[model samples]
Target chain A: MYLKVELNWNVVIPAENLDIKGLMLQKAILVRLLDDFAAKKATKDLGYLVAVTTLNKIGEGKVREHSGDVLFPVSFTCLSFKVFRGEVIEGVVHKILKHGVFMRCGPIENLYLSNQKMSDYQYQFADNPCFLSLKTGSRIEKDVTVRCIVIGVKYMEAQKEFQAVVGLEGDYLGPI
Target chain B: MQNKSGHFDAILLCFRCRHFYNLTRVFFLACDAVPFVLSLCLRKIYSRLRARLKLSFNMSAAGEEEENAADLKIGDEFLKAKCLMNCEVSVILEHKYEQLQQMSEDPMNQVSQVFEKSLQYVKRFSRYKNPDAVRQVRELLSSYQLAEFELCVLGNLCPETVEEAIAMVPSIKSRGRVHDDEAIEKLLNDMSLIKKFE
Candidate 1:
């Protein structure tokens, strides 16, 4: 799901980007903010920072005594994609393994749907491998969109990424 | 001598009758005791099982083990924040990229991989393309008084029927007690109407 969250952060303007005119200073800060926003792609708290919608406030700059850099406190609202447990999300199947399949849902790339959860489907070994449903005769192969319920979510703080285990055990949760 | 022998046989028969009656009374007592003992054991086991089941039920209700749409674990900050559907996101990203291109000659370097991938994903999955249709869809779903998350899910997925919608988002049926099947059907109808017009 995509959420528009309000956040406050302090952005620093190096000596090189600093300018005398107010308009140029504002432009420099805005550019720095966007660059920083792009660099910090994802956080544990806010799944993935997609885009900055609006810049609300830029506070008075405080000069650093040692480095001659100006620190500005900024508040903005940005779009983030965070998947909660039990969220029914659709993902494209990217890789098919013997035990399970890996899918990419939004910014989350490591969504694992194990064969144990897909009781109705059997792993068929063909020229193109796929999980063939016995009841419906539908196949889940490469690039097929599958709707699954998030069973568990793990956040890697170091990597600023989320990994989830999804399941097709629920009603109407399967290949779409 | 014959009279004395007949008296002895009568005494022996009387003693044998008393012994047989005593054996039958003991057999009946054991049969009665068996069910009483079994019932006591069953009652103990049942009470223990009921307590355990109650504990598990309470845990599940508290959103420990199982998570439903109603009991989302997303932080309170996110719950209050406005949610954007896939279609809306596509519009925003496209506009941002356009703005970037207008501002600078090299727009590709300005945007990150996350931006490009997101733009692509939303473009592929976005159900509604027209901006007016997107706004109308949001307004229509909002009228139903769904949670922000639920509203976006329904918008993004665009389930054709109430049954499919309910299946995709179970909380709509279980959490929103005011919304019955007919109301949901009407909601779905309105959504489809907008899509049809779009």
Candidate 2:
């Protein structure tokens, strides 16, 4: 589910938090830098940051002489999407495999719907495998929009994000 | 549009039994929460019930073991997409949009020039870019007690026929129709999927 989460972050600015052309630190530039740092960042608890929706609080800046960079403490409200177990998401079929298709579900790119999850669907190989259902003779192909429910989630340590295994075995969650 | 092997129906049947599976899960969670409250025998019974339910589900999965295994089972945070078309005019070089336009020419886009545009822009929902359609469908289906993925299905597929629609969607009692025909029809029309249905 998508949610608004308040996150605390430490952002760094090169060249003493101010451009050499400008005399001193600026709030607008700082906020802009902070937004760039925060957007699309994966936090420990809060899924992925979509965008900086609001800037509620800011902290004093500390400058380092050796690095000539300034570090600032900031707290902001950002839009985040956290895919939970049993959560539903919409996406398009990106890659067609021998077994199933991989849906590029927003930040969760590998949300998979295996052929096993497809009931009564048969896989045919004629240079390409199509998920064919004898009941409807329908073939779920690549780029088809599908509704899917997240059945299982396993956090990938390499990327430090959760990978969700989505199932199409539910109501109103098939090809749209 | 094809019903070659009743695969869709099999999936629907599995969905129909989802509530039973959920109930079993709840029972298991309850046992775990209050281990002292529930006896060892009851826990064993709960596990047995869950196992039985899973077995029943396996049969419904179209006899495809690998498909079920993958379904029963993405670390890219950033997307590197160059918008070939800006807000203004776009130039399609490696273009392939005729097939999508053939599906449905959505009224939401530039109606006059929709045929010339990319399907990506015409689609309301996307996992990478837009969440507007997904959010709207979620809000619409919130009243119905459906699984999270079900909303995705409804928004994505937007099935036309009653037979196809009913498989993904739960029963609607307040539609005042005998068999949810009108509701499903209205939903597809409302979602601007008349071309797809036709």
TM-score of chain A of each: 0.97, 0.80
Instruction: Report how far off residue A8 is in candidate 1 (Å).
Output: 0.7
- lDDT for model 2, on a 0 to 1 scale? 0.54
lDDT of 1 by residue, B25-93 (tens): 887888898899899999999999999999889966765444444354455666677989999998888
**Which candidate number maximizes DockQ?**
1
- Over B1-198, each residue of candidate 2 has an lDDT whose tens digit, in order, gives 467458787787788679778988988988787876567779889999999899989855534332221122111121111111111111121122343356568533422121222233223342212234434444554444433334334554455666655654433322343445675566655555322332
| TM-scores of the candidates in the order shown | 0.81, 0.48
Q: Which stretches of candidate 1 lie over 4 Å from their true place?
A: B1-73
lDDT string, candidate 2, A45-90, tens digits: 5665544546666688788889978777778765445565544456
True C-alpha contacts between chains kept, each model in order: 0.65, 0.05
Docking class of 1: acceptable
Could you tell me the TM-score of candidate 1?
A: 0.81
